[model samples]
Structures are given as C-alpha cells and as structure tokens.
Target: MFRLLVMRGFALLLLAAPAAGAVEEALPNESAAHLSTLGRKPDWSELDKYQATITHDEFVQLFRQIYATRGCNPDLIKVELDVARILTAAETQNYFVLHFAKGEADRRPVPRWWAVPGALPNEARTAGPLAGFHIALDPGHLGGTWAQMEERWFRIGDAPPVEEGNMTLQVARLLKPRLQSLGAKVSLVREKAEPVTPYRPSDFEEIARQLLLRTGVKDARENFDGPADPEKEQTIAWQRELLFYRNSEIRRRASVINHRLQPDLVLCLHFNAEPWGDPHHP
Candidate 1:
C-alpha cells in the first residue's frame, strides 16, 4: 500500500467525484512527456540538504534563478517565490519532515488525490476544467502605465492594471512564462527598455494634451459640430494622427506582447464614456 503523506498545518483533501451512477471517471493518465519540463522532485536526503544549505530568501532566490535559467517558467517561479515568502523556511522544513518520516498517518482518508507541492498532473485537468479554457483578459493600450496619469484608461473605461506600462509588464510576465511552459516561443514588443514603450508621466501628459488639442473638442462649445471649423479641422486632423500614432506605439509594445507573450487568444478592451468627468481609480 502506498501510504499518503499528510501536510503540517495543512490537510490535503480528496474526493472521487462520480458520474450519475456513482462511478468515477477514468483517471487521467500522466505521461512523463507532459511533465518533462518539471524535472524531478527532491529525494528526502536532497530535501535535507536543501533545508540545511538554503536560507528562506536564498531558497526563493535560487529557485527564481533556476526557473529563469532552466527555462522552466517565470510565473510559476514567481508563485513559488511567493510561497517561500508566505511562510518561513522553518515551516517548509517541518512540512517536509512530517511528509517523509510519518508515512504511518492514515493515507489522506479520502478519495483519489494529488500529492501537494506537485501540481495536479496536467492530465488531471486536461479534460474536465482544462478543455477549451475560456479566459477574460486586458492589456496596456495607447501607452498606459502605473506611474502615468489615469485619464487615458479613464476615458476608455476598461482600465488596465494600475498603469499601462506596469500592466504590460505584468501581462508580459504572466503571458511569456505560461505559454513557454506549454512549449511556446514568445516575442514581446516593448521590453522594460528604451523606445517603443510607454512614455514617462510628463511625456504622457504632453502627449495626451497634444492629442486632446488635436481633437478640437478643446474648441468652444459654440464651435460644436459644424461644416468643421478650420481651427477645429486642424484639431481633428491632429487628433486623428495623434490617436493613431499613440496606438501605433501601443501596438509596437503589443507587437512585443504578440511575439514574446503570445497566447492562443487575444482580447482587447475598448471603452467609450460620456466624454465628461474624471474616471474612477483607486
């Protein structure tokens, strides 16, 4: 009998969800090929050495470097790194200690289960929750970023993460790693570097103002909707060019997003408002 390992300060739950006849679905077969990138779990002795040699921060950092270096993944690395921060290394030590030594504990006392630390085999979720996964996503468009003014996303209404820049940063972060794990090669448009990226706050403001002026919405209300006032015409012309230009810049970054953070699907958000008042933000 393969005795199950119980966690410390954690209890692993299991259930054999059955079909209408109360019979379970056939277990999903886990092939080594599907998990080849994951490498192998540590032996208890290796865990001991890992415990003895690695500090909490060091443990996390080492794994981060491992993920980045081995081409394992970034997001999973980040999640694991977060897990390291969630509890002291001491907790990790205790958990593993109970795991290897106390196999005598009742083997989970439940139905079919997955071992923790080990994610559910890709095969397990392959059909049930994994089949035709639907995702709702957004991205940094028209040069949004965490540090810049909020007005851009405000007008659009479908806000991005904080700022367009940082949102892009995070989006790229999630996108590249996840797809790469599943055997993908992604190319991002705007990295955290110069040119083809969102502008700084001052620059974004100037750009926005320039764009607003070009729109002729700045023209007096008396000038509203005519055979097109010449000044307003100039504004409209500039607005069209500027909006397209800004969007081009965004797509330049998006082009990076397209290549590097490529997903099987893309969702873009466009919103229209009353064109009055400041938009909501936290």
Candidate 2:
C-alpha cells in the first residue's frame, strides 16, 4: 500500500506548484546556535522508554507532533499502515509509518540543526555546497525487453527510435557527476536495464491474473471454437508481463528506495510523448 501511495504521489509532485521560498535564511552563527540548542542527535533510547505498542491513530498523532516540531510539511509527507508483523493474536495490530523525501522541500529554509551524525567523515565536510546531502536517482521503467510493452518506445520512419527508460537512465548517469561535483552523495535505484526487485511473474501469478481480468485483456467466457491460436496466446503472455512490470516491478523499486537506499531525496526521471500527426514533420 505504501508502494502504491509513493507511485501515486509522484504525479502530485510533478503537478504541484513550485515550492514557496524560505521566509528567511539562517546565518552561519545562527545555524550553529540552533544546532547547539536542538542537540546533536535524536534520542533513539527514548523508543525503549515508551510502551511496546500503540494504536495507529496514536502513532499518527505522535508523528504529526514530531514533524511539526521539526518544521516538516505535513502535506508533503505520507503516512501508511504497516501490518507485515503479526505472528500472534495479540500482535495482530496495525502500525503507521511515515515516508517522505527528506530535504526535498523549500519549506525547510533553515538548514538542519545537526548533520547526519555518521554520514560523513570529518575531512569530507569541506567537499562542496551539497557536502552532506544524499540523492537517489530512479530512472523509470524496465527498458530492455519491456520497452515497447511498457509503451515507452516508439519509432517513426527512418528516424531513430525513442526509448523513455533508456533515456532516463542516460539522464541519471549524466546528472550524477554534476551533483557529485557539488558534493552530494548519489545512488541510482537501478543502474542497469533489469529491475531492482527480485520478483518474477511466477511469484505473483494470481496478481497478474487479476490485473489482466480487470484490464479486459482476458475474459472468462470468451474462448475460440478451436484450439488456442499461438498469436493470441503470445499476446496474453505479453499482457501478463505488462501487468507485472507496471504493478509488482514498481512496488519493488519503491521498497528499495524506502528501505534499502533511504536517501535524503528521490528523483524519478522520465520523458513524455505526444501524438505525431505526421511521422516526418516533427
């Protein structure tokens, strides 16, 4: 569900108005003073001091308080229910988890009070403007064998074909160094044509079936009078692959971003296409 929300939120991010600028900038001395007052790190030990469990609503309230105190924008953050752990009857409770792109908002005009404690060694802090920032680049789509099926590949006449997945990857590769030169740490969600998630069609056959049914790619009552046609069979297979790529594959990428990389900011790169009235004109 968190994966679904993240995927859906990308559209909102693209459509949102440019963030309003910070009300005021913190001077270096003021930044240092703020850091001193806020302390050097969050107290994780406090977690052990709290009750073992809390209602989902309680967690949301707590998270809101924490976010407000830290001046985070609630509108930009997403909170979702996590129910992966429920081994016992008493443990069958749902909990809420917050997900957001750290440092991606102009709302945080003031610099963070303390640097991520272990993010940098003492010497590297002098690297450049983005010295301590971490950015994750997610070049969208599985381009290799799935480009055409994903509807991200197009060719008109003798001109070179356009592949959105491949293009985004190239962009990410090129942008990495430019950001790095400014001292930001960078990671790519996928460095190659393959998906980051290990899931395959066989692993979620039921999901594929449902997706095909919902999309009208397959029908319960429609059947050929004779034996199955090879071409139709092939089309069905491709449709399943499309469903897996769109749903499962993307969710896996979200998992990698939220759990494994956990970078301060995430960028999903892609290209848009429009109808070509004349193949050669544009």
Candidate 3:
C-alpha cells in the first residue's frame, strides 16, 4: 500500500544566524530563559550559506504556504520587503533574518553538499535516475519497549499490538536495498528499535525541572529527588520521559542525518492513524 503512495520530494532548509542589533534585545537571566524542553540556543550564522538563494516573492510564498501553516503563529514570522524576520526565541526579541534575492538573475547558486541530478556525469545518469543520489531512510520512532510510551502502539481485541516504530523500520529495511539497486547511496537513520540519543530520562530531570519552572509551576526545584510530594514528583518524571523520547531522541536522529549522513534526500516513514481512544479497543 505504501509503495503505491507517491512521495513528493522537497528541500529541508536549516538556516541560522545571529539576530541583528534591531532584533536582539536584552535577554532574560539564565533562570528566566525560555527554550524548548531540551532545545539549545540557535546559531544564526548558519543562514549565511543560504543568503540570496531565494527571491523575496519565493521566500514569502514558501513561508506562507509551508512554514507558516505548520503550527507556526503568524506573529512569530514577519515577512519584510527584503528579508524575513523569524522569531527564534519566544518571549524574547531574538530574531533570525533571511535576506531575499533581488530577483531570479540576482539569486546565487545555492550552497549544498549533495549532488543535483543536473550536475551528475553522463555515466552516472545512464546507470539510473538516482545514480548519484544519497538517500537516508529514517524510521519514525523507537519501538519495542518504547512503543507504548511513545503511544505508537495499538491493539484491537486480542490482535497483536501494532507497533509503528518497528513497522516503519521494516519498511525502511525493505526500501534501502531497492533504492541502492537504482544506483543510489542509501543510509538508515536507525537499524533497530533502540533510541539514538545517549541521554535517557534521568539525564533530562534537571532540564525538566527548569522547563516546569518556566511554566510557573511553583513546586519545581533543583536537586529534588526526595518524594516529599509524590504528585509533583510524578509530573517531573513524566516531563523528563517526554523530553527524552520526544525532543532528545528526534534531535539525535536529525544530527545523524544532517552531520553524519548528509544525504540528498530523507524519507521519513510513519503510519498516520486517527485518534483511537483506547489501544485495546482500536
């Protein structure tokens, strides 16, 4: 069924750079800093490579049609005449600006590590359409023991539980060889159901406490391992586990794909299902 589904290829841009003086205001103290569960500060200078690669119209189109629609608030991104200002840190004035190309003639050649189809040699083109392509297959989640925790496991009556992570891995395993057969270099983000992140839930405990405090949870405290308040302790534990499986794990996978593999294309496999209230029932 998945084989019959057509997957459209798209560019995934990761641009960053320090905000200009106009957008960079006084930052809050460390304790009052705002960040994602386990996210770090962005290095905006990375956007330098993408400078003048897209026209103002093109940038606005992609921003509105793609990025903005992806759960991003309109107020977070301001499209200007020559640049798009994106808010990097919420509750702060920190912003990242992406300068737009004047026009098609003014656009510079995009700096990219992957070889484009038009750039491939005649010999490679004759081999296959994907002859010089480097593709990475990313299985969606960590299955096995983490399937239930990630809520990707479901069962109907006495049927075996449907594990999305392992299933996606199986598809990737089957697809890798097929892509290689087309003369493409292929890499898997993960081969098994284990996590790629070295840090576990315990490692994120401190970070979780900080995140809770930012949310105005007054009970949050540092070096808090005692069970003085079980309810609050449970909330902290839950937050830690969520950060481990959701934030840390995906970030590690992205690092492997962007830095290690540097693939031209990435196929992230997953099964999208409607919310079924109880796993046992559906």
Candidate 4:
C-alpha cells in the first residue's frame, strides 16, 4: 500500500510540472520580420483622424491592450504624453517601443520583454501610486561660461553669484531619484549645464547681423563704412553670438523633449532675478 501511495504522488507531480513551466516562461522575443511592421511609416491622415477622436488616456489603454495581445509583458512598455507635439513618423506608428537590456544574453536585434530591467509583473504596481508614469525635467539656460551671456548669472558684491542653469540642473538631479523611488520613470532634457543643440552663433551670422543692427548695437550712422573701431565690431559680434546660442539652445531642448523622451509632463526650471535696488547694500 505504501508503494502504491508513492506511485500516486509521483504521477501528480508530473501532471503539475507543465503548468509551472508555462507560468515561468518568459515573454517571447519579437522577430525582425514582426518588428518591421512597427517601423512602417504612419499615415498622417489616419493619425490626424485618430488624434481628433482618441484622447490621451484612451490611447494609453489601447496601447496596453495591444501590448497584451502581442504576447508582450505590459511592464516592458511605457506610454507618455508626447506633449512636445513633435512625434516623428516612426514614433507615430506606435504609442511606445519595447525596451530591452543590453549584452550577450539579448543578442536578438528585436527587443525582448524579459530583457527590460525592473520590469515587474503587471500585478506588482500596487506598491506605488505612480508605477507607470513618465516625467521629464528640463533645466533652462546654458550655464558654465555661457551663463553671463545667457543673462542668467548675477553676482552681488563678493558673493558666489547665482546661475539659473546650474541651479536648475541641481534641482533636476534631486527630483529624479525621488520620482524614481516612487516608481515613476524620469528623464532630464538637459542633463548638464550646457547647450543641447549643436548650432553655434556663427551659423546664424546673417540673423545676428539683423539683430545687432535692429538693437542699435551696429548703428548705420556710427558704422556706415563697416565698424569704425575694434570695440564696436566686438560688441556687435558678441550680441549676435548670444542671440544665436540662446535661441538654438531652446529649440534643441524642445526637440529632445518631443521626439526623444516624450514624457507625460514637462517641468521647466528657471530662476528669475530682479535688479538690485542698491548694489552696495545687499
């Protein structure tokens, strides 16, 4: 009788093994052929129609449903607002892309849901209220040597001075970890105290000329026959450079936020300063 009972237990274990294996199976990796469809160009007309009818929340819900239907782990996909309103044709094809890990284990060209780090089971979101939110922090202005040119730096007396760019970067760094701890995905538009765009002042020399002339820095009367003195020429050039850098940096940051990160919310940090009432007093 004991031998018969042991045989019965072994049979039961064999029967349960397939169920356990199915539960433990990783999400299937997409094939290159399957991924090709994801890269298809968007029909702008269709996208416009969808944009008219589909609210942001509805799009997110639709994405989640599609993700599940594709046999992908829902945690591997993230949906953001695309608030910059600069979605490229490729990005417009899908609400979100599957994020994967790097290295030998994930040699597949296409992303695998199991490769995504910190991709908890769909049921694990109960731990944090913001489990699936994406947030972006944009620190305003170019700091470092460009701070003075950006007009975001001011020194009073022997004080260390205040730089808006540096201050915003610090704030973003502090806020990133806190948001991540709360289970929110966070990204910084400008990670450091530098310009995001590769454009330089010299690139927009013509625009700079118009700006300087308009601003009276290059007066027609004073420099009718070109700059009269080296000082006047230097002043015009500096103003032109500043204008180019300022506008280019802003445009680049917007591109990064809209095309690349596409976070649900954008927090632009800036520090405003008023002219000192008495420079010597405080």
Candidate 5:
C-alpha cells in the first residue's frame, strides 16, 4: 500500500497542472503572447528526465486516461511509434520530442529526486518502515478571515461556521506527528490559517483587467470597492481576488513542494460541504 502511494505520487507529479505565474523567460518575438490564466510558459527541458523511462503503451494510457481526457489533439500533440511530439510554443511551432521505451526491458529508470522505501540504503530503512519517505501535507485553503472570501465557510443558525480550510488544517496537524513517529519526514505546505503566496488581490488587478478585456468585456472597471452584487460579480475586482487566492496561492505552495521540499508524496487534504436546504435544520 505504501509503495503504491509513492508510485501514484510520481504519476501525479508528471501530470501536475500548469502552475500560475508570469513566464520565467519570454519566448523570442512572442513576449506579448497571452498565456493561460495565471499560467507560465512551460520549460520543455523539464521533460528530459522522463525520457525513455516510460513505455509507449504506458504513455498512451496516461495521456488518454489522465492527462488529456478529451482525446489527443494532433495540432498540440502527436504520438509516433517510439516518440511523442508535443508542441511547446504554438506561435513558434516549436516541439519537444519525448522518446518512449520499447518495453519493460528497454525502459530506463525514472530519474526522481525522491527515493522509494525499497530503494533506500539499509541504514535509512533501519529507522522505521516509513523512513526515507518524504511526505507533504497541504491543508486545502486559507482559513481565518479569508475563508468567507474563498467560499470555504458556511453557518447554521446558532452554530459556529463550518470552515473547510480550518478543519483540514486541524486534521493535518494531528496527522503530522503520527506520521513522524513512523519515521517519515513530513512537511506542511500550509502550517497556519494564512496564505502561502506573497501576492494579494490588489497586485492582480492589472492582470485581471487585461483578462477581462481580452475576453470581450468592453468596460473593465479600474478599481472596485462596492458590495458583492450577484449581477455584477464578474467585474475585474472579483476576478482579481479569485486569481490571487486560487491561482497565486496554489502556485506558491506547489513551488515549495516541487523545488524546495521535494516530497515523495503530497497529500492534499480537503472536505466537501454541500449546501443544506435549511441551515437551521441541517
């Protein structure tokens, strides 16, 4: 069961979503190109480590089942007998080729920063069953004063509000020491009820306006300080806040886990909260 989790973690890292941020380096002559929402231009060199580590069939299965469920796009990606050609920059028509192994015998070991339990040295394993396992616990959202803004909170009549972020953090805190006792190194993406990103909603205002205008919103307002209006909810102000909390915060957390901590497994803890017809009764 533990080994399975580590493998799943490896797969998750491979299919990780495009992160939020400005492009680290601009493509020549296409510096002004519009990227995905808060998305950076991907570094194709990152795929180098995965070369020849996966079989052709395995690549197809992961792509069809996990990466792109709607089916492959020939324009964006093309699969051949032993290599997958992925378009890195559409404007430049640049492609990144990934070579696949012929079969299990032909496969190269996947190069990863983290080590599995069985791969660890004997001394490392002597600590405990979970020794050498690096686990990252990401308690979902930013709780506290920001919970209501992120919409992770709700209240019943006389009862205290149920905040999903706070609850997840509580669970992570309780689970941390228990996992440590098992000799696994545990790290928390969010150790408190605050945000992980240094950026705030105001910092995203310009980007939000640009997005709104590009999406054909004729009059994207400059600044917004009014009450929440359902009819006017798609304004720049609302969009900026959404980008800050959802995109920037998540990207920062991912950066910490991927680059700094390099955990073997990342457990994102969350709880579902469905609407109750009557808060008082439910």
Candidate 6:
C-alpha cells in the first residue's frame, strides 16, 4: 500500500515518534522550552530515543481532510508537514532528541493558516458550533481474528513487536465503552481476524498513469491531459455514476443505521495508513 518503499537502515530513528495521535489534554507551557536546546537539525541520533510511532502518510491524510473543509491555504499546511517530517527524521538519531529541545511549541512549525487574518474556518469561527449536531460512532473495519495488541516497546526503525489487529481491538474496547457512556450509539466495524479485503477506487489517477506508461507517454510525471475525444463519455459517465453510487452508499448507511437506532450522531473511526502523506505528532 505504501508508495515509497520501506528501508531497513532507519530503525533507530523511528524510536522518537509515537503511534497514537496527540492527546486531548493540553501540554504544559514548559514542554515547549525543552525541545529548543536540542539542535533543530534532523538526523538519525536525534530520532532514536522515542518509539517508532506515526508515519508521514497518516499526517498528510488528515491534513487533506481538514484542508478541504477549512479552506486553508496549501502553503501553510505544507510546513506542518515539514515539521513532522523533520521531527520524525530526527528521531533516527537519539532519544535525547526529546530532551535536547526547548521552547516546545516554538520549535514546532507555526501554522501559517492560523495566522491569516479574519480567515478562520466556519467551524472554528462558530460558537457552540456542534451544540445540536448528533454524530454516529462507527469503529470501521474488522481486525479479523485475535487482534492482539502486544505489550512491547519499539525502538525506531524496528518492526512493531505486537500485532496491530489485537492492538486495534484493545483500543475499540476502550472507545466503545466511552461513547456509550456519553449517550452516543456506537456502530463499530468488524475486527475479525480473517483474510484482508480490498476496496477498489473509481479515481482515474491509477488507471491514467498505467495507460500513459503503456502507450510510451514517456513523461509519466507530466500532466497528461485526461483522455477525452469530446466523443467518449464512457469515463465521464462512469465517474458520475460511481460518485453517485458511492455517495448514496454513505447516506444510505447513515439513514439505515439512524432509522434503526434513532441516533443523534454518527462517528466513524478509521485505522490504517497509505503512501499518501506525512504523519503529524502534534
């Protein structure tokens, strides 16, 4: 699933990053002061101290999601991407990378979009924004048999000692209980430990790239105008129909679940990564 092939040399570096997302709790002011004393440069010794955690792809996926909804400038988003890249890369060096740093938040890249004047996203700008909105909780995907989250520590650049499948179920155990306590209905995806399943895409990028390569459209990286004779509506019609069916499925699922459960909210939890983008620690 990853576009960039994995390398074996970076084991120590992966140590500094963690697998989980940032906590809901706020950081103390002094946390920022700690990272500064560490050199700002990215290297292997700077990375190995922490556990191997999030990947770049995970970070970028989220950035894209927020970008589409927030109308934030692309340039600003990229810096945070760079920061994650730098920090994680540094972890390949040493755990002291954590201690050497100071002025915590300052060490992190400042999001330019946050500074754009009077340009807050509608969600951010809203007061009591989600007061009446109900959400559904769906912990998506089945981990298939014995999703065991092993209790082990990972040094950077090393494979996870525990199985991810079990780890996910353990997480779901914690999550499902919490949401139900909050008066929210939870519809979790199957985590049964079985054979893996593949979801197909209707997007043209993969198909287009293959066709170009096969046809000797040498510069595969160059923007190849999509095939259109203004005559062939095949791809166009297929695109629209796929989109409609896909969107309808989403709504249909929501409606069916809500109708059955009379839910006030829908919450979908996704697990996994791709070659798409950088993973942010913050």
For this target, which candidate reaches the highest TM-score against the unseen true structure? 5
**Model 2 clash tally, residue pairs:** 0
Q: Which ten residues in a row have the lowest lDDT in candidate 6?
A: 1-10
Q: Candidate 4's error at 134, in angstroms?
A: 1.0
CA displacement after TM-score superposition, residue 198 of candidate 6 (Å): 14
Candidate 6 per-residue lDDT over residues 90-150, each given as its tens digit: 2243222222223333244422211232343455434333322334454443333312211
Measure candidate 5: CA RMSD: 6.4
Cα lDDT for residue 63, model 6?
A: 42
* lDDT (Cα, 0-100) at 162 in candidate 2: 79
Look at candidate 6 and tell me the lDDT of residue 239: 34
| Candidate 5 lDDT over residue span 1-282, tens digit each | 322232233336544423323322221222134344565555567668778989889988877776666564476677999898776665677878999998999899876676766688888767877898989999999888988778787777778888888999999999999999989999999999999888788888777777777778868765555444653455877888888889778867877776677788899999874346685687
The sequence of per-residue lDDT tens digits that candidate 1 reaches over residues 1-282 is: 001111111111111111112222222122122121111222233223222222345444544453233333221222332233212122243323312112224223322112332444566554444323322234444343323222333335465333444555566667765755544334444455234533332333333344455444464222224323455434433333333335334434434433343333444533431233454542
lDDT of 6: 0.34
lDDT of each: 0.34, 0.52, 0.69, 0.51, 0.73, 0.34
Q: How many residue pairs clash in all the candidates, one count each?
A: 15, 0, 3, 0, 0, 69
- What is the lDDT, from 0 to 100, of the residue 71 in candidate 2? 37
Tens-digit lDDT track of model 2 for 27-70:
11211111221112222222222222444465456544532434
How many pairs of residues collide in model 1? 15
What tens digits encode model 3's per-residue C-alpha lDDT throughout 58-122?
Answer: 87676557644343445566778898776666578877788899999999987766666678888
- lDDT at 102 for candidate 5? 87
